[model samples]
Each structure stands twice: as structure tokens, then as C-alpha cells.
Target: MAAKTVTIESKDYVFNTLKEAQNYYDAIVKELYNAKLTLTTGQDFEDLKWIYSTYCHYTKQNLDKLSNSDITGFKGISTVREKGGQYIPTECCAIIFSDSSSNCTEEEFFTDKALKEIAIKQNPR
Candidate 1:
């Protein structure tokens, strides 16, 4: 089968697979780091990078091998939904953390101080 292809956001290049896209993204991240152009997302860019790296590793390898640390590392870095002010983290433990399909309340998602606390909690020790 042909490798799946995807276009990266905010860029024009196409990647054959998720791994290829990630490699390209990693290269850009490295270049940004070298140029001191990294922007802080959630906590620091470095922390988010580590979390994403861990996520990618578990996804590529056996997900059954994922440890508690791996899930906790990224579970708290929430992203705001495009349509609402609600915060949504991609994964939490074995759950794909999203409230889109449920009758979740706005309070269910972190915001303001709660979001900040999540970021702080996810930060590396």
C-alpha cells in the first residue's frame, strides 16, 4: 500500500506519512531552536517538545508499553477548541481526551487558572 500523505499546517510541503511529517516538523523545530526562535507554548517549547516526543514514541512503538509517566507528560497540555473557549487535551491515560462527542459542560475543560495549573503540573521536574 502507498504511504498515507498529509499536508502540514502553515506550510506547503506534503509528507508521505505521519512519521515523515513528524521528521520534517522536528527538523524545523531544531532549526528554530538553533536560531533561538522557539516560542513558548503552554509551558516552554522544550517541555511541549518532550511531551510530543514521548507521545510519538509510544504511538510508533507498542502503545501497550506506555507508562503512567508518558500519559501524564502530555495529558495536561490543553488546546482551545476552534469554536469555543473550552480547553481540550489530546490524550489522558488510555482515553483520547476530547469532550466533543459528549454533553460535556464548559466547566469540564480547563481555562484561566485551571489551565495554568495544568501546564505547571505537566512541566518537567
Candidate 2:
């Protein structure tokens, strides 16, 4: 048996010359590289969502109770909105990255204790 070779050609090729085809191929390669560069992992995505929600809640509460100057002085704050909404703070990142200065704030610790006490009184536990 003899080896056979076949060649295929498009009569109406969009790119008339090999250089044009190469240019198109190069453009597609660049686009693919750029797209890959922008991808993020699932865990990173979820953490971002949680950070956004927490920041939104804190910013809303803090801003409502303080003046603009006072609000700006605090770090790691951004615009706050209902759980699902569109709004971005002009001057802050939508996430906070910090450690607790205390294990829990004085007010929150007492409030949590009070709630636990009430729960215990309601049902013996």
C-alpha cells in the first residue's frame, strides 16, 4: 500500500493572504492570554462577597450615626447598601482587612452575654 496525502482549500477564504491569517491568529492568542490573567479561584470569590457584605453593614450603621468628617476618619469603610444593590464608595475599598483590637468590644460582649442569659431563662440550657 502507498501513503496518501490530502490538502484542503477554502475558495472564498476571508483572509486573502497567510500574513492576514497570522495577524488574526496572533490577536486571538493575545485576547486569550488577557482573559486567563483575569480569572480568580472560587474560594477567593466567596471571601470577596462576604467581605463586601460585612463592610456594607458596618459602613451603613457607622455613617448614619456620625458626621462625614468623623466617618472618613475611620479606616476600612466603604459605601453600604442592602444585601443586594448597586453602589460603590468613591474613596474606600469595599473590603476591610484587620484584626480585632479586642477579642470582642465591650458593648458587643455585654449584649451577647445578655442574650445568652435571656435564652437560658426562656429555656433551661
User: Who wins the lDDT comparison?
Assistant: 1
Instruction: Itemize residue pairs with steric clashes in candidate 2.
Output: none
lDDT of each: 0.35, 0.28
Q: Per-residue lDDT for 1-125 in model 1, tens only?
A: 44445432223344465455545444544454355452434433333434343444533543332332222222222233433675553311111222334331211121122223333333424
Highest TM-score: give the candidate number: 1
Off by over 4 Å in 2: 1-14, 37-125
TM-score of 1: 0.27
Backbone clashes, candidate 1: 0
Model 2 deviation from native, Cα RMSD in Å: 25.9
Clashing pairs in 1: none
Question: Per-residue lDDT tens digits of candidate 2, residues 89-124?
Answer: 322222222223422111011111222232233234
User: Clashes in candidate 2: how many?
Assistant: 0
Q: How far does residue 113 in candidate 1 sit from its true spot (Å)?
A: 25
Which ranges in model 1 have alpha carbons more than 4 Å from their true place? 39-125
